[model samples]
Target: MKKVRGIYIKNSAEIALMREANRIVSVVLDALGEAVAPGVPTMRFEEIAQDMCRQFGVQPAFQGYGGFPYALCCSVNEEVVHGFPSRERILREGDVVSFDMGVVYERFYGDSARTFAVGTVSDAARDLLDATRESLHRGIAQAQPGNNLYDVSRAVQEFVEARGYSVVRRFVGHGIGRKLHEKPEVPNFVPSGMAGPVLKPGMVLAIEPMVCAGTCEVEILEDKWTAVTKDRKLSAHFEHTVAVTHEGPVVLSVS
Candidate 1:
């Protein structure tokens, strides 16, 4: 297993494996995106993602990872993240679905997510999704050699809060490599101090921002995994596994 630290660059072989793992994750997300629509069972989409991983000779990282028991996190409106796939939750018009996926190839991992609209989503919902995605870019811009992790967090928090949205605090981004959710948890909003470690080149991190249309507070479902906004308002999440490089930040999970 790769050692977990605040910041470190990977070697060429590790980079190659990570690229392959991220590629599978990217393709699986694209497949999931195409299959999501009104009247479609969420589990069907999860099955599609699982099938794609099998076809690619990779394993869904979330499946059996800490007993998650699902290939993908199919979060519908108001659900922040970790929504288990179920046949009963058929997506309907105006519903927003967030698909968070990860894959493991050759013992390396990649993670990413995208929130999609079912059909004819409300303008407010559209703005929330757009803002959440934009916050991803805003956060990634801070992943540089000379910057600290809080820079990334501050970037995400400022952008979302300025738009009257709240960043979910319970489930933040994480460092991922040979294992998913490694050391040095990356928060979407900065903590109250300057103690966060500085980023360095070759550090692979999944920078995901979960933005809530209502309050920042969240609650876990009965399954003890899916996190939902306390006020039942819509939420959006976007993510990309990124590596800090001398040139800039490069997103590993590209589609």
Candidate 2:
């Protein structure tokens, strides 16, 4: 691998290692998604993620990274991102929970996130989830060679706004490879006067979109980790680690 203008370009070998790392992330997330229920404690998902990481012989990428204590980030309704998993936080009917997870294998990192409804939810909550998820795919579709990085950002922003939703500006997507977070901060909205870097082959990015049913502004809770919407309204998050290749964007974080 080599760094060009602060962005790391992966070789074919390195990309293969990263694929394995991301596959582990996908497997663990699938398990967590299946375990989401109305009565389960949020911490149970963390335990399941840790066990899967051990079974796959990989490391929990978030654990101890910047002092994060758990393997998964369980963001409940109104929580935007980085919510700590806890036994005290129980899943309830009509609540939407977002699970953000990552794993490391052979020194490469893979990251992904998904928001799941606890049970039957309000129609507004369901619409928010659908729009947020669709926006993620729209962003990923723009991850191709010769496209400006902001192309992906614009795609996400436009889609979310068209549906009457707001994108979380404070937390953006990022590059991922040997390190969990890399250069080329991938914002969901395009900032004025910034064109961003050109997409190129071998560039891997974790494209995540956190959408809010209310205002885009958010505040960190007393825990200093959980971020909640200012209006205490519904929020949803979706993510996928994608690779820019000769053939276009290939989603790496998939089973």
Candidate 3:
């Protein structure tokens, strides 16, 4: 279903709490990023991330939320997102893993994701990740008051397609605050026709761009959560929780 929500701008005090939550989220990802290497088990990475969240007195936003069992979404290679962590699968050289995590502190939530290449990866895979990351930034640039949601989508779509890539249409970014997901569904690609309503100040959004190396089409695994490219090609994902302000779009989840 199409999601359209009005922006919910938080006050100064609420923004402060949200920043602290995001800071911990950043730390968790930093630890995970550093440990991402050949021979490391994804379950071990999840343990480290969960430990970090507990140390900060925060809760794993994904755990138990809509039946997501783990604290992190561990997607490796062809797996796009929501892959279950398992010790059975060890990280190998040239493999790329995407970690998507969310943390809640003082009642607010912060979510973000990063794709890391284990050891050395092929030029093609590296370029794919770079393009997806850049598309995220391009989408962020349009997140100001008075701009439509499609404006952000157009920026991301244009950049990815120009580079010979396509974005996953099934999942897109959404509003976030005290809850994991709120109003205003943010699409990474243009939604058939014109853009949605103009953006307004105080709206917090999680803008994630998932791009595929081949066709944009995707299929969910039998596991019922992990998504993968239908053509069996590679995909990359990058995300950031941003807030619209009079000053401009502020990326709250940057580490």
In the range 105-187, model 1's lDDT, one tens digit per residue, is 98889899999999889999999999999999999999998798889999999999999999998889988887788767899
- Compared with the true structure, model 3 gives a TM-score of 0.96
Clashes of each: 1, 0, 2
lDDT of 2 by residue, 1-255 (tens): 888788999989999998889888898888999998899999899889988988998899999999888888989999999999989989999999999999989999999999999889999999999999999999999999999999999999999999999999999999999889998899999999876999999999999999999999999999888999999999999999999999999999999
**Best-first order by lDDT:** 2, 1, 3
User: Model 3, 200: alpha-carbon shift in Å?
Assistant: 1.1
TM-score of 1: 0.96
Residue-wise C-alpha lDDT for candidate 3, range 75-130, written one tens digit per residue: 99888888899999899999999999999998999999999999999999999999
* Pairs with backbone N, CA or C atoms under 3 Å apart (clashes), candidate 1: 9-202
Q: What TM-score do all the candidates reach, one by one?
A: 0.96, 0.99, 0.96
Flag the better candidate by TM-score, 2 or 3: 2
Segments of candidate 2 deviating more than 4 angstroms: none
**Stretches of candidate 3 exceeding 4 Å from the true structure:** 1-5
- Candidate 2 residue pairs that clash: none
